[model samples]
Target: MTCGLFQILMISFFHLIELSSQQETRFVYETFRGQENLYLDGSATVLPSGLLQLTNALHHQMAHVFYKESIGLSSSRQLSFSTHFVCALVPQPGVEGGHGMAFVVSPSMDFSHAESTRYLGIFNVSKNGSPSSHVLAVELDTIWNPDFEDIDHNHVGIDVNSPLSVGIASASYYSDIKGKNESINLLSGNPLQVWVDYEGNMLNVSMAPCEVQKPSRPLLSQHINLSDIFPNRRLFVGFSAATGTAISYHYILSWSFSTSRGSLQRLDISRLPEVPHPRSEHKNLSPLFIVLLGFLAIMGFCTLTGMYFFRRSKYAEVTEAWEEEFGAHRFSYKSLYKATKGLTRMDFLEEEVLEKSTEEISFQTEK
Candidate 1:
């Protein structure tokens, strides 16, 4: 009986090793230079330095990026998983940037039914809230999507099967020193790190500047079960990004993921690629330019006004006492001045002579 029990114990130990090996999923792409294991579609591309760029500076576009191999999610028990990625969202300067990117985990990479724009290329309008979709996402949304009932224009959300979030919070990070939440703008055009971990039916999402270490307190901590999303299959982890009328370039500088809590590799900040800074879109008129324009406008108005009054003044007549003897036949000097057009006074004498001659002829005929 002792020998039989020993053999069974040995068998059980080997079986445990096999399951552990299968459950272990680890990958690191500090830079994607020569790696081809990533499956990119639509607008996704791997830059020269292994930077994963999803969606271009163009609008109304979508992209998907996924790891070639799938990671198994155990059905018998809830497994632990952690992933961290550094991303930089460089938006077109001087314009509102839309729709953002999401770290997605899906059982199937065939996003044929998905639509771009506010959907983040994950699902279409018709399937956004369907109960069967089992899509898990951590979205860093820049545009306010009223359709999804988004809380604000800039927020991070935990979504299941829909862009509409189960839990949402404005983009922010908890500062240990300040002991409060500090707001973060997702479109700030700076490289930032996002960490997601799921263990014991709890999902925690945290973010911080690339230079700072992970904070003790996460930005979001909510209960979630991965087993419920994918009951008996492996899931592919990747990113989905889309742009609407507003455009932004979404880039993943570095990424690392593992199904084990402490074994997940840390992203090397020093070796990571630099974020592309956006140009200053809010153009301000130079004070000198404004002053110059104002000076020119004032000078133009003053010069024209002065010239107008001066010309009118030249036609001003005092109406001497002798002028009233003509009664109704009297013409005002201003009328004659206007008829002369401010020049050629000699022509006025000839014009008056012709008029007097005609008047005399008419008077003689009447007599």
Candidate 2:
């Protein structure tokens, strides 16, 4: 009886350990296949290339796509997420790029008031400095806004409940496999990877080119308490982007998120899928190029229409002026034919000669 009791106690302890492991294993992952579980708003769409595009050739457009199901982010627990993506911003030659794109965890996924261009489709002019808007976003900004006091035209910004950045870093990546640092242009139209982890009171953001391994040192590390910022435990995770007169093509190749309060290893890295080959920047035409082509076509059509109306108006003016001078009684073809005996001047002259010759011949015969 003593041996049996000891064996039952051991079984119960092992069962409790198994339950704890299962509870911390929740994960959310997606490769954006056919816009499966995503909610698209505005210009967002799944392209034929299998990339999830947030915005297309439109100007003054704001677009975003969020997970249909809300992510259960706990204010008390730690969370880690890694996104593997590629973005191509083809701005007009002399003009600026877009406001930017951001990975956001917000109280709600609605962005109806977000403005285009410098606002990044995450917030509008009214919400820029507002305190009530609760949000945490990692922005890949390609343009500089004087209102936000951006450090440069190209940088990555980490924001808490505001469009103003708490921290900013010029976009760069490690060059060598041995972790030698190199600063490359962020908007060079290459693929990049960004990792965000929140553990304890620290938030770390690391970024690198897709070719290099993940960097050991984070570009930006700051201390903040998530519980204070986000009183609401539940949040929505997704992406947002916008364009003013400028434009860009924002894409999400793959993404994975884990809600585990345990080690980062517990979060499955294998769930993150591989991205497709980087698209050729030269092969893909600029959104401005397409816009210019459309504009020229419309202008050509308008010019032709104006010319047709102008000619029609000028002809009408001449006819009206002539009618005003002469009392509206116009010569008809039938009246003219009767007045000249249906004969031209040459025909009338020949007929007159024939009649005179016949009369002369009759006179000679009588003589």
Best by TM-score: 1
Across 1-367, the per-residue lDDT of candidate 1 in tens digits comes to: 9999999999999878658646688899998778888898989988776688897788788999898999876545677889999998888877788789999999888897899888999978888788678799999999887878999999999999888899899998888888888888899888989999999999999998876788899988889888778875678999999998889999999999998889998877998887766668568799999999999999999999999999788776666666577654655667876676764467778889999999999999999
| lDDT by candidate, in order shown | 0.87, 0.69
Give the per-residue lDDT of model 2 (tens digit) for 223-267.
Answer: 866666667655677888888787766666556555543433322
**Measured by C-alpha RMSD in angstroms, how accurate is candidate 1?**
11.7
TM-score of each: 0.75, 0.62
User: Could you tell me the TM-score of candidate 2?
Assistant: 0.62
Lowest lDDT 10-residue stretch of candidate 2: 261-270
Q: List the residue pairs that clash in candidate 1.
A: 32-50
Q: Candidate 1: deviation at residue 233, Å?
A: 2.4
